[model samples]
Target: MKPPTDTDTLTAPADATTVENPAVGIDQTAGNFSYKVDYAFDAGTGLSEDTVRYISSVKKEAPWILEFRLAALKKFFSMPLPTHWATKDLEAIDFQKIRYYLSQGQKPKRTWDEVPDDIKKTFERLGIPEQERKFLAGVEAQFDSEAAYSNIKDIVAKQGVIFVNSTEGLREHPEIFKKFFGKVIPTGDNKFSALNSAVFSGGSFIYVPKGVKVAQPLQAYFRINAENFGQFERTLIICDEGAEVTYMEGCTAPKFSTSTLHSAVVELVALKGAKIQYITVQNWANNVFNLVTKRGIAHEDAEIKWIDCNIGSRLTMKYPGVVLKGERARGEVISIALANDGQHQDTGAKMIHAANHTTSNIVAKSISVGQGRSTYRGVVHIPKHLKGCKNNTECDALLINTNSRTDTYPAITVRGDKNSTQHEASVSKVSEDMIFYMQQRGLTEGQAMSLAVNGFINDLARQFPMEYSVELKRLIDLEMEGSVG
Candidate 1:
């Protein structure tokens, strides 16, 4: 496809700020735009028990939830940064300097018409409304600390599928939400998870009933609008026996002079004979510290898969994981990451085989451009007791400059002779000769480079939904031009 033209831009309403370039991002990367608005509620700066209590009180949360948040705040304070294993850049995150919550204090509207104009314009510029109208079964748009709008298609809602933000799920569907919440990835799972549990706000909560299959995908969009702020959203999805669903999320934050934090926790549970597919595509500004933890559990004869794509951030450390807990369960992860100058994409996957005849697969590709760095760290394990378990892993990297760097850390352990596993890794730079040939054939250097990069990850990109895959390719093409610039 040729490069995106001016017509492809996403424009805001007359009153909201407009980004001339559709590629100005948060559409894909920079999320670089802003507008004026007044927040009715604020948790103020810094993290403490008082901050947590204020958040709980503002939400009118249950006493048990307040208790949980206070406990998590203690856990967060006691834990230290994982600089020993992770990058030292994480040490720069000043917990006390960040504002935990800022919102307009509006309940999520079921109709776009009821949404405040400013918030609605933000989502409009991001194409949230248009996309939902075209294909999604449900949609949620979150700005800073709260969801501004959330709606589900009538047909899908009639199927007994519950799609709402986390607050509603906890208060309205506690009988189901309480059991699975924090059970997959608890507060102590990591420091960031604890932080999220303490101040968590807007995120998608979906429950698919037994034997029900959602026909269209459900999508959520996350935006961070303020400076020196943190957005902590919690998402949980549960698929009952014989049910199936696909959920996707997109995130972006505008450029900030100071550091911004986007820490989130996601959990998924697939019951017997159920299937769940999760997809995330994030493009953040260089000021964002994108640290998130996502994991899923697959029960007997169930399947879980994650399709993750990362494009921009100052430093990103995320590893999506899956635990195969019953006989014949399956899990898979497909990932693509691009790191530009002054950015690091540290990402991978983890798979644990716990029962007989389980299987897992992982495929990851990275592009390092102009001194950018990308690392792939993965773990796959099958204990000696598990028989006939199998796993396959592949990591590939493409460098666009001599200074670009990539690393691979694969920890694969299979104890039983009955288990089988395979791993493959490759690293290479962009071929100057191919770029010259494409230029000779009437392609610009940027176009040629984008073509080469797209070729390297096209097969993996196709794993996304059809329209989204096309958009993914466009995203790559646009970012390749920026890398060259």
Candidate 2:
């Protein structure tokens, strides 16, 4: 198929007019709090190159990180537009027009109450604190550019599990931070990753000690309330030998006419006999660009899993990958995506087997409504030297309307005759008969459609922790209501 040639063009919205009142908190839905292109960097304005330098210099980083940033900046400047299976509509992103970072204070609050009232209100509206107060083992809340509040249970901390913001992890625990910061995914992996490396900020750093098992999951909440802005958060997780940890991230942004960017890089390392599970649920505004890179490395006898869901974004490009570097290592990815009216969601996963007796699995489901489009692009490889390796891949798509579209592209290479590989794909539409049956059962058309959509995603939801599973179901129900009618 010929590539799409029409580059997207985004016009700036009218200049923002906001009224500042010390008595009233910043309104998340109001334009007064939105981001605008400003030449000067001051207390009110967001982060700049100077701010990046300040962060690095304050950490007293080794010369290597600085050198890496300089090289990454060069790559970010020279890299051309991505033409591979992407919806060219995202080409209009104006790098110079965005504020790379925004924050209300200097450092992340050590205590929950230390967080500013305005930012706390934003989380309150989203029911974040309630989630933590109910069941989460720990919670980290990031507003705009930086984490405003971060806390871990005393029992978990006493068990030698390190949970904190990446910036603080680097400043206080340089010995461990330097060892695995970029080992899983290098700085020069891709253009957006390189950009994240050059100016990354405000993401989680987690380490689970040997022989320890965390009973409850840790969570992070990210919010973007500004327009013409980008959030570049960096996250890293290390599960030591025989340890286990589950991490979840949830995000939302307000609506805007102009485009915003969310480009982040995440890496995970699972050592021998360890297990790590990473979950991401993203609901961006209708006019934002979501491009992210996430990958993990599993050593001998280790396991790693990724559960991802993408519901809203003008354009999205994400592919989570895993590299099995040791005998009997395991990896799995289960994802669900929904695209609505003028949106495009392109997502998949990669699995590479470098040792004997390794296994991998991939299950992906996509829903397209209105004029939206969805695609599944993936790769699986087993080298000739490997033996007794196995892989299974499944891709499914559900189209809600005649105008919606879905595509699947899977590349599998198995050089060893002893290996086993399986691939299956299916595309189904919401059947009229099924809708009729539900309608006859005393349900409205919209309610029936929403129930069907939820059923399609129910498999993936089970992989999430109980609390997160409930939240994800609710979010999907809300999205379904808007499209069903």
lDDT top scorer:
1
Give the per-residue lDDT digits (tens) of candidate 1, residues 1-485: 11212221223443433545443223544356776655667788898888888788777788988888898999999999998899999999999999998877778889989887767667776778888888888898889988888999999899999999988898899899899999899999999999999999889899999999998999898989989999999999999999999998988888989999999999999999999999998888888999999999999999999999998889988999989998999999999999989999999999999999999999999999998999999999999998999999999999997899999999999997999999999998887888899999999989999999999998998778986787677778878888776
State each model's CA lDDT, in order: 0.88, 0.79
lDDT of 2 by residue, 188-225 (tens): 78878988888777899999999899888888987777
Model 1's alpha-carbon lDDT is 0.88
Which regions of candidate 1 are displaced past 4 Å?
A: 1-30
Task: State residue 261's C-alpha deviation in candidate 2, in Å.
Answer: 0.6
Q: Which candidate is the best by TM-score?
A: 1
